[model samples]
Target: MNVLVIGASRGIGLELVRQYLDAGQRVIATARDADGLARLKDVGAQTIQLDVADPASVSGLSWLLDGEKLDLALYVAGVFSTGGAISPPTQQDFDVMMHTNVLGVMQALPQVAPWVEEAGGQFAFLSSDMGHIGDSRSSRGWLYKVSKAALNMAVVAAQPDYPRAQFLLLHPGWVQTDMGTSAAALTVQDSVSALRQTLAKHKSSKTIHGCDDVPYLQWDGRPFAGW
Candidate 1:
């Protein structure tokens, strides 16, 4: 399969690239710092340079992949910032998060979405339980939760418009990575394993579930409010 992974330089993204490459799939991995992703190149993954926050960069990638057929496009690029009841997000932090998590979706549609549409491939936005209003556990990381929540809704809204393609919003759980931290419940490998298993079960049906998390303490972003 022709697989494209954005943000493949570190953590879960890096692991995803490794797994796909080991599966003998043609994998194209992207990172803002191409040098950082050199390990992917060493592992036989074709590395592409990408900055999800930049429209120009997204457009450049779109042009590069326009002629190619892509079977899977996974948006794994994300950012996190600390926020608490007393300390809300700065305008810059909010903009950066939304730019990558939300605007990146908008940017990617013109590029990879068409390939998925034509090939009937699968598309997924890495989502978080922080967006789940159904859960009552609150989180203090406003930037991460809100961006993920917006991404989930974006996936829900866009799934239908693409023909033959299945759009999924997945919660990878609290993984032990720079973002998830050592206190997180799952290792990056374990989390990716579960996430891959969940993704492998996709059908044309319209529904969503990837072990939901309780609503936690989020800052002012209202990451838990899904409506």
Candidate 2:
């Protein structure tokens, strides 16, 4: 299968690339810097230099993957910030977080979704339960929460346009990554394993629910309701 992993430098993204490669799938991965590219290369993935937060960089994506039909596409790039309503985020923090977490995905959607659609594939975005509006209790890292919520909306909004691709918003749980920190609940391995399992079980049977049925799921396949 052909898979595309966007923002595959480290953490969940990197682990995804590693697992897929070990499974003997053809994988194309993107990283923003030399170190990241080197790491992906070391793990045997086709590497592309892409900074999703930059429009100019994202604009070249379709060209990069031309003629390729992707069986799966994972948008796993994001930024995290710590702040609450009381500790208002600075303009810089807001811009960086929103640009990376929300705007980057928006820019990448049009570029990557077509390839996934061509293959009747799955397009999954890495989101967080912290983004769940109805389920949210704490305001800590509220800005980050707002960014992920916007990301969820972006994926849902784009789903209808890519009818053959299953658009999924996945919460990888409290993963033990740099973003999640060491104290988080799940290790990167366990989180990504369940996520891969979830993807394997999903197929582009749009007829079952049509394009409007974008699924918001956890790493474990449990559906998350109430946006």
Candidate 3:
């Protein structure tokens, strides 16, 4: 299958590229920098330069992949801010997180959605459980939480526009990555293994449910009740 992995510079994104290639899939990996692109190329992935926050870059990506059809278009780009209090976040923090986590998806969805739809494939975003409004009980990573929440809604909002493609919001289960930290609950391998299995199951099923029914899912492909 042909797959596209956005924000594949490091961490979970990079690992996904590696594992997909190992599975003998044709993988296209995108990153914002030359170094990241080079690293992805070393792993046998076709690399593209894309900055989700930049409209020009996003538009260019559409032109670049115009004729190519993707079986899976996975967006793994996101940012996390440290401070988490009742107080509002600083303008810079808010902008960075929103731009990377929210607007980034907004900008890329339009371009990638058609590709996935044309191929009768799936579009998955790497979302977090922290974004679950019904599950919130503490105040931590407030900025990141807000951004991811917005991302979840954005995915739902876009679903109707691309009925042929299945849109999914996935939580990677706090894997050991830069964002998840060394003390995270699961390793990158564990998370990616489950993720691949989930993707395979979804592909085999060929059924797309309503947004409310399957909005958010765990890494293992089970529906997340809290969402």
Candidate 4:
């Protein structure tokens, strides 16, 4: 199987690359910096230097991936903002969060979705349950929530254009990553393992959970209600 992990410098993305390589699948992973590229290379993944937040950088992705039919393509690049509605986000914070969480996904969709479609694969974007408006509880990271909400809409809207590929908006749960913090519930390994399993299930299913389209799902393969 051929897998492409975008933004694989560290955290969940890096772990995904490691796990897939361990499973003996051919992996191509991307990182924004030299250090990140080195780490991915050390893990035995074919590496690409990429910064999803930059339009010019993302524009060349298709060229790099030419002639490859990806079995799984994951858009895991994201940034978090801690400001609530009352605290109002700064311009820099807003740009960083929105660009990484929403705009970056939009930019890469056109480039990578077709590759996944070619192999009847799964295209997943890492989203958060905090983005679910109906399930909203706290406004701890209101800016991030808004950005992810937009991310959900972007991926779900693009699904119709790539009907052969199963597009999934996934919440990896509260993971123990840089963004999720050490106090989070699930470890990175557990979260990513479950996410891989969920992607496998979606890829093999004709209709997920009896639904014709599965727009949003948890890492454990459960669908999100009112998302």
RMSD of each: 5.6, 1.4, 1.5, 2.1
Q: Model 3, 108-196: lDDT tens per residue? A: 99989889988898899999999989898777988888888899989988887787888889999988998889999999999999998
As a whole number from 0 to 100, the lDDT of residue 128 in candidate 2 is 89
Candidate closest to the true structure, highest TM-score: 2
178-210 in candidate 2: lDDT tens per residue?
Answer: 989999999999999999999888665673243
Model 1 lDDT on a 0 to 1 scale: 0.73
Note the clash tally of each candidate. 11, 0, 0, 0
lDDT-best of 1 and 3: 3
lDDT of each: 0.73, 0.90, 0.88, 0.89
Best candidate (score: lDDT): 2
Candidate 4, number of clashes:
0
TM-score of 2: 0.97
Candidate 4 structure quality by residue, lDDT tens digits, 1-227 = 99999999999999999999999999999999999999999999999998989999999999999989998999999988787877767899988988888889999999998899889888889998999999999889899899999998888777877877888889999999999999999999999999989888767524233223755889998988887
Higher-ranked by lDDT: 2 or 4: 2
